[model samples]
Target: MQAKPLTIITQNEKMRNIFSGIDHIVASDSSILLIGETGVGKELFAEYIHRTSPRQMQPFIKVGLSALPAELLESELFGHEKGAFTSAGNEKKGLFELADGGSIFLDDIDDFPYQLQSKLLRVLESRELMRIGGQVSIPINVRLITASKNNLHDLVEKGIFRADLYYRINVVPVDIPPLRDRSEDIPLLAEYYLKKFAPEKEIKIEKEALRKLILYQWPGNVRELRNVVQRISLFASNEIKVEDLPSEIRNDHPMQSLTKACHRCLTNEEMTFEEVVACLEKNLIQQSLKETNGNKTQAAKLLKMNFSTFRDKLKKYLME
Candidate 1:
């Protein structure tokens, strides 16, 4: 049973070794940075850390740093004092104070601007927060767990982020690999979602459908797979059939958009400019003629070429 949202799988020795050090990672009195791609569940992993830690009973404050306007993010994180801004009527406690004695998950941490890095550095260093425009610093003991879907090294090289701050937070780095790299787990994930989603809609997933699902690359990762399974379970029958797949996946989607769309790619690579043009002209003429029910004049108009020119191109391609 997966007790946490970020189901930490110790499937391999590598993962087992990594997870073995998880206690040290979470128990450290310093900031922990979790890095992974979008949709790979970085926030979920952060939640796991909070849930397993001693501060599990305390509120787990979630701060979406990227969602916040950069101008006001610092104020939101560190709190604001009276007259700090046009709307600053009263001194407000930031996430740090609100999450005192608990864990704070800072999602999309890379979006944090360098301008506020020093302010954040102070908070991390002092274990306290000072509201904007406030004279007195408030002591707040909050464990910080941050996640980013970006390459911090690239940001550092570009000089957009502070190197000192990056090193401070990256004391124990947890990098989550994408779903594609772990295709071996696709069947497992599919079955899990199938069991979860099937009962609500009275449906059963077909083994063949599961096979197809496992084969395709889930670009959107687990989230995308969950969506697919959800839809299938909702619309499909007690015994799911291959034909019951969503129309997009059921048919040859790439070619059916246009009959000649597939052919375009095939012969384009081998044909010279004139040959390619001739092929395209033939295709257009044939398509227009078919749509117009073999009416030459209508086909010519559709092709936007005169009857003679259209006929000439058609014959040229046919003979070639």
Candidate 2:
């Protein structure tokens, strides 16, 4: 099956480069280890890789290790035969078995039990598993993708994670930068979530509101941002203003400073229309460049301009 278009909207140079690298890795059958903070969209990245791989038509199963109790996680991952345990009245298939010929994503792999890591490593190495209380070794052809909020390397050093298992899964490591590190993508992500949650409404975010969003440090990352947008959109009018934002975001000091600047600009009558527009454009471009750490490509993307057009504007403003 043809893969659907990617919904991972990002223009940050680092993320773009990571995606490009992932494109090459997806063609091959290799274990992928995605490392990132919680709510940084590691699971989404795993799904994207699976969707783009040859296993697009096959089943894609996701199991969160942290969510499952240790007592049931083993059976949930490797399945169980009839009478394997008191609750096992019927034979059951595991996530790996269900994901045969496709991909299986194990989220929060760092939280996976230490004892079970060896079994998981064995599966990765042999591509086979034996259901609990069963004699047959069932072969599987599922691609393995594991995600961790904590660094597996450090966990291995601390003896929390199995070193061998870590090596096995770390075949292709993908690190997702936190939202705070890639603030340049904030506007785009906020807009994307806004459209997703309120598709029926043609809502616009005021400049001050957007500045507040961009300035606030998103502790919960993309997930929190999505929730914030959803909440604000629900109560907002045709336009979302600073006051419509959550209290934590609305009261940010940086946002207050930006609002003051905007007020000053509006009150200034000495500045010509062309001069005011030019000044605002220059400031926006500079801000974009600053957020992207001087990466022109990403700065242009943040400004919603073509690379050539952005360069021309830079030259016109004597910014280059």
Candidate 3:
């Protein structure tokens, strides 16, 4: 049986458009690219596509690209021989074969290395896969869907990502705007989780607490919000109150500071709030670099920034 597209629980026109776009792309065999921030429910969107796609009856395989090492990732994607590696106990069909007549979700495609990109491209183009430790190739009939939190175009510019591969997977691109950008959807999503989690724990959220949840920026996004609801539900009376909400949101300092810092720079064009915060962030990063003795890479992690983002910030701040 095919899973139906969960009645889209949204009213925002932009998000509604994204849902329609996904609905359209699923009907064909085109490889799709879903780009957004972490905790943005990319996988849920993938499931929505698969359930609505023509291959709904077949397997829906998901490969977490970030979880596997290069050598293992290759075999995991395109299965290897029984004795292909030091620890091969049995022959396993690759995800492509498992998903034959269905769909394969390659989550976190941004983490794919240069070496494995070529093999993936080959399989994508020909719809064929070879099992590890096997000498023969098998035909594969599956749709591809990839999700990423990183910008593929930036990766291409740095040569870490192959341009051709980028084009291949990016054939049908869908952008999932962050939760903060789509505040309208928060109340609905919150109520969805609250009811879903509440019944499991025999608790309920007061109307006011629900409103508080709807107002927060939720930097951690849906997942974090769900966790907050779950945590609060455990201790919440049959009726949850504002006092029961997580302390972080009630007294969220970093966000408060960030919010305050942003409000102060609202009128600056050349220095948008993001730029201002980033400028402050760059200063912090530069301090880390100085402490680390001019090592930009290490300084990046110290500042909790992506290496590339850190480098870009360095250039933007004229630190280099």
Per-residue lDDT tens digits of candidate 3, residues 1-320?
65655656777888889987777767899888999877888888898999998888789998889998776787777887778788987887777888889989999999998988988888888878677677787999988999998889999999999999999999899999777678788777766776776776556567777666666656566777778877776676677787887764554333343444445445566886667777666557655664334756545654678897888877888887
Expressed as tens digits, the lDDT of each residue in 141-176 for candidate 1 is 888898988778778989988898888888878887
How well does model 1 score by local distance difference test? 0.73
Off by over 4 Å in 3: 4-7, 200-208, 252-320
For each candidate, what TM-score against the reference?
0.72, 0.78, 0.78
In candidate 3 the C-alpha lDDT for residue 294 amounts to 70
Which is the better candidate, 1 or 2, if ranked by TM-score? 2
How much lDDT does candidate 3 score? 0.77
Candidate lDDT values, in order? 0.73, 0.86, 0.77
